[model samples]
Target: MREHNRTIAHPGTREEQMANQQGNQAQGATKKRRTFLGYLALMGPAFVVGAWQFGPGNLTTAVQAGSRFDYTLVWVIAVSTILMIFFTDMSVRLGISTPTSLITSIKGHLGKWIGVLAGFGVFGITLMFSVGNAVGSGLGLSLIFGGSPVLWTVVCTAAVGFVLAFRNVYGIVEKALLVIVVLMGLAFIASTVVAQPDWYRAMSGMVPSLPPGSEILIVALVGTNFSINAAFYTSYGVKEHRRTRSDYRDITLVDTIPGIVAPGIMTVLVIMVAAAVLGKTGAEAGTIGALASVFTPLAGPTGAMVFALGLSGAAFSSMIANATAGGTMISDALGRGAKAGSPTARIFTGVILAFGLAVTLTFQASPVGLIVIAQSLTVLIAPLLGVLIVIMANKTSLMGDLRNKWWQNLFGAIGLIAIIASSIRLITTLLG
Candidate 1:
């Protein structure tokens, strides 16, 4: 133990360095295993792609699909879900290659102008994630235990923030959200099974068709929810997990599959419920509250209670996701990660929550408000991200040998076109 040590700045032996690298890589790989579970056991910390898709916004989409169009737009969600899967694969592939985030990578690859535009688009996503999650949480809390919706929302957010503020927030959030999603998914599927609608219409839904003039809004709405952004977030989430190129392909499957399957299944169940229950009534009801009311008489008090609980969970989980992504985006934009209870971190969550709360509290708007904005914004972001992904994937150095398959590119291109077309329709409707 002689202290004749080397204090000089000197490189370690090559073997020593390699060993350290391998050790670090092993630690990272362990984290990756947890990350894989993170993909499956999605709860409160971050979001699972479909988790947002099935939230309060989806309630609106499902309700309207039945209230207005019957199950004519059912296929929209199906088509969008598959597209989301494909695009999510592309995003994970590209994001894993770049050191930056999915958004930053898009910025780096796309020119300044395009990058800047996409950055603005991320703002809209911030709003969607924050408001969506908070409102959903509040709604879930309200359903589970009756209280002021706003009060419940803030309380739930604070509670969640409390958990997220802790060191081990991931597991808690993951388990809770997964339970919520499973509960919601099961209940909705039960409802769908209980009431089987016309298979003919459900099948016909897969075949895309433009309805009469303004009626196309339903299709646009469905398209909006099921589109590319779901996949884009998956890639971002994968990167957040610190996965490598080897993880890319599998990550895409693990991430996008749930995102696609959950929402797509939920979509079918919602459409089935609508077609069976309210297709003839043609109710203008678009809120989760309305669904609860409907369930009360039809399925009884328990049904209403459970449905409300699901809605609340959907909204709250969304808030968690929104805050997580929004905070990350803000920090990334400002070049700071949302670590613990920093002022900048709280602000990231707070800013988005305030924006959503203003709309919800002011107009007494329902979750549909998030959808109207969220979907439209994604309509823009999805296409832009899709194109950027295709571009990035084509660059051989980025993807290396495991670049985009021919089919991935084809789907990516189709997704871009679909998103752009949906954007045009959304804009036209807004202008008119």
Candidate 2:
């Protein structure tokens, strides 16, 4: 038999039209996926900073703010987050502009001592953070597993040390922290949903009240939420990822704003939840256990578990970022190296971990106090870092087109004043 002619649909035929629509849909889907992945690729450095900021210390202050003052302190988180985005954006620009790490660039533009001092200052702040991280990691695990907080602290520290001991440390740290931040966000959001916080009152909390006797808690909240040191570290992350000036805008949109805001929103949610569940009954969440317990009556065991998970995730992620940042900065300060995988950086990181463990073990009786104190102490050193970032970001020689605009400088100055005022308040509170 002869070959038969094959049937074909005309261009305007139903079959042909359906195929065209399907092709267009497939192309659209593919483009959307690629765009999302592009954003994901830019997500590392900022999320790591967010994880570091939202650690146990942040959780503690937010809990206290909610339990003690209800949502009246939510404005602190909101303001701090906005200021944080400005500082982080500056750092991102610096990262794209500088030829070396942030500290190294400081050494180049400022004095050597200033660079070393910035590094040491950051290291000192991280040391304070480590204490809270150690206590928090253990306490969170204990709340979930019914074990000694000290034991879990040890386990968490060791695990973090092992993770940091490897090569490509920044890459590992960035990816791990991104995952942790997402999980922490979900847990807090879920807990908030269960708590059914008072929406009207919570909104009113955004009106900015001092609420007599809220000084220390407010200081701690700003310390953990604004976190100039964390913002300072963002430049290092940008350098590590080899980002360029062209990538700056995208980084701010995808990474910096969301990364910083994630923790801030979570903090606000925590405050709202605590106000609803704990403040109403005048129950104080003085410890992680206490915080978790507040959730139990409102949503039962599941609620407590969710809060615990968020706490544990925050602690663990902060533990990693805190140690890594301390190690890297100190290493850069000492002229050893800027890479987290460097031998000197790793050594310093291990020392930070050990220091936190030692301090936690020594002061096992008053973890909540230690966390608040540690967090507040961070505010004292933050003014210097904030000033340094502002000065560096304004240098036209370095930042070129990416230098701080008038708006950035405006907010940067505001943030600096806020941090300095917090420092002064903390000093007076401690002395009194």
Candidate 3:
């Protein structure tokens, strides 16, 4: 009886220990998952900013660069993406440090006129890029299903308008952009794998070299990837998410990593696929359709389908975000709320989309020409915006302990230099 009682007691003890151990492990896993999800939540705004910047213009530029110069221009994409990280980080910091939107901060620091002018500049830039978004969305639809670009353009414009018309625009926009970003990531990864690019050449391409007549393509790449509007829009996004300076600034900065890296990876993959499939064959991607066709020969029907899907996702995602940026900035500039769901904001967004659709449909402008013009405009505007952000960020009164660090200022200066150089080159190209 004694032995039986001892055996039972010992077994119960071991069972309780096992159960406790299992409970601890489970708790740890749950905690980890929660932490991961928290980080992902923080990533929402950065992802949208990235998606907005990566749009159809970026796709066209990458395709052209790869098809034209093989992997030789990959270094430009790399450098530009790195610069974006710095700019975006500064924007994020600025957003968190202040209680209001970026335009609002500019208004307080400068004057109402400067703020209004900045708003108009951003609005114009967004409108210019919206043309590409319209073209891209239309092209994507046309590629997938037989239809007129005009019909699809109108349809896409209406669809974006419908989405923006909603009262809870920010939430819907963020979630939609996240979905599109995921789709883009998967489609591009699949396409890149199928292309089987020359690894040796691709690696070497990371070394910077300006092949003759590559200046325009280089500037286009930088302009699209390192978008000034994206940096400006970051503050609104952070505001929409309600992140404040009291939060973990370091973690907030880290959350932008996926957003920044995803676009760069997508660009690189597009370049590689183009280099592998079109570069050798000497194919020209003067239009989005031409770019899509390159995937067919390399990866067959399925690859082409995937590329079209990714392009559409990118185009549509960017269209929504670009319009939102335009509306949000203008509305904020006018002292209407910056929240995307506000009626004033939606109206402005509609106006920008309407203008873009009208221009795209009426003029039937060359998509490539539109992209170049938009990029040049961005080059002209980015320096002023960059200077504004740097100055605002360095203000001790505004940023307090969270002001720009030595390293942040250093990178910001470098980015400014790069932007100025690109602007000069673009101006020279247009003039001469």
Candidate 4:
């Protein structure tokens, strides 16, 4: 009776072990599910950066690359993308470690003037990007709805302003961009499917080569694709999302790698489709309208409309991200505030929109020219931005354990070299 009572009181040790194991299994499953949901929640910042990076300028350049040079330049996009991921990753770490905005952190670590200059420099690049966004948005809408391009530009600008005017501006902008990127992704994927590019040749294009007269085009491709400024703004998005160190690994897996790579893949698809559809004919799709027309002949009116919608999505999404980034950064630079919804940031955003609109209206004759010039000009400021990101990420005191790994600095060095080389080429091109 005593032995039986003791057995009942304790159960068997094996039974207790079995029960604990089952409980742990259930807990592990729940923890994994929670972790997965956390990843979904962290998806915003990088996509926003991606949307900003793959704008009208990116589209125009990719189209030009495919149509004019065929697959020879695909390697440029490949290299730019790999380097971009490194720079953006560095920015992500900085965002998580720095106490305040990236610019503020720069002020703390680098110097007040350097931070201020970085802000203005980024703002300047955004101004150039805004020109492409304004023109592309106008042209894209006109292609879809059959309206005056200028009228659509104004409407789009006002619409963006309205979106920014809301409370929780960063949150609103992030969500809006997410939707745009999804739509753009679908449209491009479908377009690529219908266009039916040559698989073997497109794969071969992965090898880098410089076809004659491709220097300037290559510069434009690197400028738009590598896009150090877009990478720089990523930290702001990270800070806005309030990501912590615990969130870093998950964020990289779910957000940073995929987010940056998504656009790179889309850009590649665009190049392949263009090469298949237009390269053989030796026809150059220099402008957005010209690019859209190429799809119509290949896939009918529906295809054309699909491509136009993608363009509109790209332009509008970029407009929002670009202006918001510029405004927020500049405001932070001037000691206003870093948050997107801050009064000064909103006002500065409006100013950016207004500047783009005014420029588009005045220089309406050459939208494509504006895009190339604007994109090329960004390289002038890009080397500086790239250096700053690498420097900030390497600061042990500032970044703690999140500081850049050695491989990161190595890639960061390569990116700086690429940007500096592009800057030199662009200057020579301008001079020549």
Candidate 5:
């Protein structure tokens, strides 16, 4: 055969070149779709973590703050929410970088007893707080459907039990929470608009001030919004999602923004509505009934209904998340898996849910008191957890390149100081 030289055109014939271009476009589109879905999956855990703050406990506290002090305490929500973003970011980093649960990490670095104590504290906090969720759910149902709060509590408990029992419970929970969050946003935003708050006062409220006797309300606001258990749960939630170290980059931090911001916005709306209606009238909202009344002046009967719906959504979503946090933490503490759908997780979740139901039915405690008490108690335990997380995040061995930078450490320290101060104040208030 004669020697031959051949040169291949980049894409061969024009038809072949067009086909190749089409194929490339198709691949690009597929890649974009995959990335979009990955982002959505990453959002699941953070959204759940954020939605946890919108519970009935928070609702009660925000209502009290708004009704009692108008926008005077809105600064607390802003400050607490900013701290939430920092802590939650640390959680995401921990979850993506570490191979074990936060408790296990603490045990490895700190004393075993310290880790054990922290675990127990988280469980206790979750258990006590679950009561607020149950009561809040029941109160919401009673407000909307006109039933016994106790009866509605049992029904809501059962519904949560059914969801937790599912094999794909985390998926169900994320979707459920996302829907509930949307419902809450709509309800609160609509109510806020209807109330037509004085924008001047609302804006000025962003400036920090200590109204007389407002210390307790400020603690409640901070404690509920910047929850320690929710922060710890963020680690497990990220673990449940099975994100790799590569996912721990800035994108991870970005994903948490919506989760943090949504609940803050909801809290603000609730407060604005309360300030407009209840504060203007100097009416008290120490009870769920009174809270609902604040909404009535905003949109009449429909406003009450909307408020109840938002409250129900917050209660139910928080119920699921609170149980999951308790179950996941307790299960991890016992050396079982922390995955949301594990047998141990489900069992522990049911136990917490049952306990909450029993308490709500037996005591019939005031919803506001229940929330304030549960949230205040967290102050004692959360600082320990926050300190541990900050310490862990600073460990180069654990976090490698993703460890807390100087600014992160500075903010973390500030947050810790604020938390400790609030906790001391809470204890003092309780003691006096």
Candidate 6:
């Protein structure tokens, strides 16, 4: 007997070749199983993006929303998270089918100049936050150890950058950062529980509306915090998770749920913690690192350290994630993958350096200021990215059956409007 050679065949066309129909089906089933699990595993990194959203920025935004708006704006996070799921699934769908980052897709659909400008602008926004991350970490060090914040900040920048610089060998970095995010969650959860917040008021706030003379500044702060690059993380989560548009719809839904929920829950935690204590104490002022001024009465310096440590980890993970996302965008946008040093690796190196620049210079302990700059950039870009995606996803010639669904478009429109209003307000507040 002679051994058989197989020929690849197109579906439903016998003349195409002698490919095994049953075998292909089995392989696909197995692959789908793996992909579902992989998406779950990939989520740890993806959620890092959301974890960043909860950082020191939340210290003011969530608390302010709770205290001033009385949870009136609390629903915004839930709304935004849902919109993000819709928008990001579309992003991943476009990415896998088109095999491009959201940035590259925008460039391809629009023009190369837009792509170039977007690349530079996003990195610029991320750079500002990265600086905030580094500065925040330094504040953590200064508070914990009673040392020079600047010197500790430089050490942190050098350490995180040196680690990120490796790019490929970063499981240690990932695991360590994850631990920090978890610790951060535990500290906050414990504080909120101990403080015993008015869950009733918190729940009521979720009805979603603006209250008159309700510390509009704080409402703006919530908008600013949640508005900016809030979706940027969703894009990064999709890419790093490797969920090209090819995921089983069921799996995509599962993944999107966590990606959105984690941040939403984080939003609730801060509001609870802030209202439980800060509301009781009256108006308060302190840098994010110094949350002890408020929380210490509830948990003591030990508790404060735990809270700061958790927030710091959340912030650090976010910085690493954005850095990774920016690196990914650069590689994908310019068709610049690792030919020699590898695009991911090269970009990671740049990200580490950018961290130093953002923190050592522009960023500080003021979570509000850090979030403001980030939101401002987002307002400018969100609409463009939204329109670009809607156009790209709808082109039957480009995406065929993979175009975004009607609901996806509707949610995306909502996100766009929210960001637009947030942006206009940002400009008004900045100018004023």
The TM-score that candidate 2 achieves is: 0.89
Q: What TM-score, to 2 decimals, does candidate 1 have?
A: 0.79
Candidate 1 lDDT over residue span 26-47, tens digit each = 5445434546566453322223
Per-residue lDDT over 75-117 for candidate 4, one digit per residue giving the tens place of the 0 to 100 score: 9999998998899889988887776788987876678899999
Screening candidate 2 with a backbone cut-off below 3 angstroms (N, C-alpha, C), the clashing residue pairs are none
Q: Candidate 2 clash total?
A: 0
Q: How many collisions between residues are there in candidate 4?
A: 0
Candidate 3 structure, TM-score to reference: 0.89
Worst 10-residue lDDT window for candidate 2 reads 1-10
lDDT of 5 by residue, 1-432 (tens): 122222132223333324533443344343232366666666777778878877987898898888888888888899998888889889987886665777877766676778778877888888888898898898899999897989999999999999888898888898888888888899888878777889899989999999999987888788889886788788887877766555555345456888888899899888888888875566777655687876665568898898888899999999999898888888777778767788887888899999899888778855456655665668778999999889988877567566899999988998898889889988888878
Summing lDDT over every window of 10 consecutive residues in candidate 5, give the lowest-scoring window.
1-10
Shift of residue 14 alpha carbon in model 2, Å: 66
Model 5 gets an lDDT of: 0.80
How much is the lDDT of residue 324 in candidate 5? 84
Query: Which model, 1 or 5, shows the larger lDDT?
Result: 5
Residue runs of model 2 more than 4 Å from their true location after superposition: 1-34, 279-282, 367-377
Report residue 367 deviation for candidate 2 (angstroms).
Answer: 4.9
User: Candidate 6: worst 10 consecutive residues by lDDT?
Assistant: 9-18
For candidate 6, the lDDT comes to: 0.58
Candidate 4 error regions (>4 Å): 1-35, 279-283, 367-373
- Report, for every candidate in turn, its global Cα lDDT versus the true structure: 0.61, 0.85, 0.81, 0.85, 0.80, 0.58
Q: Which residue runs does candidate 3 get wrong by more than 4 Å? A: 1-34, 249-254, 279-282, 365-373
Candidate 6 to truth, TM: 0.80
lDDT of model 1, residue 319? 64
Which residue pairs does candidate 4 place in steric collision?
A: none
